[model samples]
Target: MSSRHSRRSHGHSSGRNSRRTTQNTAQLIESLNTHRVNTLTELCRIERVAATASDEDQLAFQGPMTSAWTYYVTSNNLLSELRGLTRNYPFSSDALDDAKWRVSNDPESNRSWNYAWLVLIKMRDDQMVEAYAASEAAKPEMWGGRVPEAEEARQLAECFAWEWNEALEQMLRHWDTPPTTTGY
Candidate 1:
């Protein structure tokens, strides 16, 4: 083919590629917006359900708790996508702020702490054995819960406090160290 003909063909292909890239970017932004709206709506619903749920009404708590867990997982994925998208495109500061706000304000943000409280309550009320048995078969390996005796619970809490103090001490020691210019 002639150089002139090849130049025209290359130009046409590049134009098409540029348009396609623009279209994909628009679609990504739209998807991010949709996900944000949906996630926020779900979070609000979860909060409402949790607020109205009674401690004795475990059934009522299940739906909202499950929804909260799902929202946590889904929002994490969306946030990761948003971070990547924002890096490539000039996403609005407001959109990024909103995403951060949603995560910070989530009602079930401290899931591990909540679970520990639930377990302690159950144990205190003498409901732990039954609850643990019912939940055991479906429990994930990393899930935190145990039908501990009162003394056992006390020991566990003490141990945790000691470990936390040790960690803080270690962190303090590291903070006192001066920065090294060497690669080491």
Candidate 2:
């Protein structure tokens, strides 16, 4: 019985394929780029807003600027670094153009991604936990009257929101140019 038990394999051969798929930095960035562009394009078409709205908005001063940084700072930082390395101090027109295309389509993808990262990093932050709790509490339907689903959702949202807010903060903090109050 002992010998038979020892012969029993812990995992099947197919289990080797059960490993989680991990994207390389470049691939990850590319995926994000695709998502951002698609999201922005759909959002613009759906909202009947111009694709250039993000461009027109000041990078430092505008609400969208804040919002953009608020969500996808890591993606922005990594891409910016890559661009700098490949194109020198001033980014090439082609790189800027590509970014513009993506930003135009999925303006908030950055935000969503950044928020998701933040949630993962600091799950125990009081503010985040509270926020998630609140959201979960709001989903009263999930509890069948006894459970506080909304509170649970709120907790989850809180975790994500912190990350997004941090990413935005990072972007604004590192911005070289002083935010222009005047129209750009």
Candidate 3:
């Protein structure tokens, strides 16, 4: 299976897209310009916020970074890495191999991608056993009540949280600068 998701080129069909461009993005860009901070400073601030946001915050930092890494890191290919490792909670050996292959050929892949891939390649043989075992660790039994279905879902969330958390940490640790522009 292909490890990468396809994206439409930004602002293709200019007239048609302009009619669709909402004020939100424009407003956000204007607001970002309103601040006097350098690009790196603002990016660092965003990384800090994304890393510690609550679940309800829609930032995913409390658990897995998942797609959130795209916001903090510049590489388009790193998304492929995360998508592979976290695919089905990140356990299939074949998928892991594909992820490593996908990232290894890209010279511009983010440093965090290399770090995360290194971390996962070591688990290729055992991640499956380890993940479900983690899922089992959170299952609680009760005397008179059935375990809630939410508990089951939480276990799945917990199953991949550690690996993704490490991924997020690597992103935060390796983030350096913005592209095509001076960091300041």
Candidate 4:
């Protein structure tokens, strides 16, 4: 082949590859946005159902709540993937900032807090659960009593509360520092 022909072919190939890359990045960003919206929707649905559930029906809501929690966690993963994909892209800075703002302002962002609060309220309204908790509370020794399912639920709620506080503290610390150019 002639040198000029070879050079032209190579240039064309490179241009095609660049265009493909750009297209893929745009698609990924769109997917990230879709995932974010879906996650938020699921979170809101779970919150609404849990909030409106009666004491008798609250137990039935647990599965949906757990599913929402899993989706929320998955949303975080999608956000991380988005950050990685856009790290060196020209428009990443604004995109990343907007994403972080969306996350920070998400209605159900505080999963642990909301879950804990809902569980506590549900348990409080359940007479059987409250009786179990009260009996356990009356025990002289902290570790000696048999933990009823209700008490276990309360403990789980408390753990969620702890996780919520820890996450909040981490967010605060992260915000205190200037944005670093390192990891996404």
Q: What lDDT, from 0 to 1, does candidate 3 have? A: 0.41
Which of 2 and 4 is the better model by lDDT? 4
Each prediction's TM-score versus the true structure: 0.27, 0.23, 0.24, 0.28
Q: Rank the candidates by TM-score, best first.
A: 4, 1, 3, 2
| lDDT measured at residue 117 in model 2 versus the true structure, 0 to 100 | 25
Name the candidate that leads on TM-score: 4
Colliding residue pairs in candidate 4: none
- Candidate 4 Cα deviation (angstroms), residue 116: 19
Give lDDT tens digits, candidate 1, residues 16-57: 986875564444334434444234334334334334444543
- Tell me the TM-score of model 1: 0.27
The lDDT of each candidate is 0.39, 0.36, 0.41, 0.41
Judge candidate 2 at residue 78 and give its lDDT.
39
Which model, 1 or 2, shows the larger TM-score?
Answer: 1
Q: Which regions of candidate 2 deviate over 4 angstroms?
A: 1-102, 105-148, 178-184
lDDT of predicted model 2: 0.36
Error of 1 at 66 (Å): 25
